[model samples]
Target: MAEPTTRPRDAALGSGPGRVLLTVYLIFAVAAGARALVQIATKFGEAPLAYLLSAVAALVYIAATVGLAVGGARGRVIALTGCSIEMVGVLVVGTLTVTDAAAFPDDTVWSRYGSGYGYVPLVLPLIGLWWLWHNRPRDRA
Candidate 1:
């Protein structure tokens, strides 16, 4: 029997693209989490749903960052799940905000498809999912 081929260790961690993605995920996680914290602390009553959504988005970003950093089977699954949730959240929240503005007095990260964040919040998940899929480990036959 032949040993299964595996990716080089350096290729997994030191890849330029992976580093960039990790950095972006980290930044988003921190930003979203901090903003949610401030919102919840100062005025949770103002828009509870929106604030909670922000927190959720922050958490997903954090998970994505961890997944990318970990880079393995478990990590990929985590990242994939996060990305899927993110996509759904953005679409739902964005539509709600636009179609029923009265329901959302305050802005969440996904409000208006992340318009306030230059649509990065909207696009980030797609990018993350794509990256994860691209880098997914292939079984050696």
Candidate 2:
């Protein structure tokens, strides 16, 4: 039997595809967080649910970024969880906002499948999930 080769803990954070994914995740984290903050501070009463959803999305993005950058068993788990939640969020919010306008008076990060953000919000989580899966660490023999 052949022994499995494993990547170093710092490998994902160093460079290459992992680094690129991390960069993207960081961008989403920043953008989502900033937008959420502005919405909450300026006029939370206008659309509390949407603003809160944005904050949750931002936190998920941040977690995913950290997981990708960390590159380990724990990181994989965190990234997977975050990505899954993000996917669900985008879909649910997108559908609700479009089908029921009364509930969502304002836009959220996932509103209309991220139309406001050029759909980057919709695509980012999928890409992050794919990257994490692709860079998954090999099991030790």
Candidate 3:
């Protein structure tokens, strides 16, 4: 008996460059989450705002990873929102960290355009949004 293997209409989201994107997102999620957890658990008082922003970045990366893995209409929407938020956060945080170093007092994943992480944080969302847009569902009329 042949078993039925259903193919997802949006499976493309997790293939090709999308796979690389997902891997990066997963790495960032783990990295940011771990860093934020350790900072918050240990020296939170030293940089509460930075630590909190790191935690938020972790959450956004996690959401984007899950959305890319899910690979469907809803997943696209989730990924879009996650990437959009990430882009804004990185830009705003990066600018603030550069213009007002005293206000930050500590580094986040998005600090200085993600200079701490090789600037991947600054470029990731742009790639993600482009991937999502490129793989968007077409009308099957």
Q: How accurate is candidate 3 locally (lDDT)?
A: 0.92
Which candidate, 1 or 2, has the higher TM-score?
1
Could you give candidate 2's per-residue lDDT for residues 13-120 as a string of tens digits?
677777777898899899999999999999999999999999999999999887776667787888888888989999999999999979988888899999998998
Stretches of model 2 off by over 4 angstroms after superposition: 1-13, 139-141
Per-model TM-score, in order, reads 0.90, 0.86, 0.93
Runs of candidate 1 exceeding 4 Å displacement = 1-13
| Candidate ordering by lDDT (highest first) | 3, 1, 2
Query: For candidate 3, lDDT tens digit of each residue in 67-89?
Result: 88887888888899999999999
Record all residue pairs in model 2 with backbone atoms less than 3 Å apart, i.e. clashing. Answer: none
Query: Worst ten-residue run, lDDT, model 2?
Result: 6-15
The prediction achieving the highest lDDT against the true structure is 3
lDDT of each: 0.87, 0.85, 0.92
Decoy 2 TM-score against native: 0.86
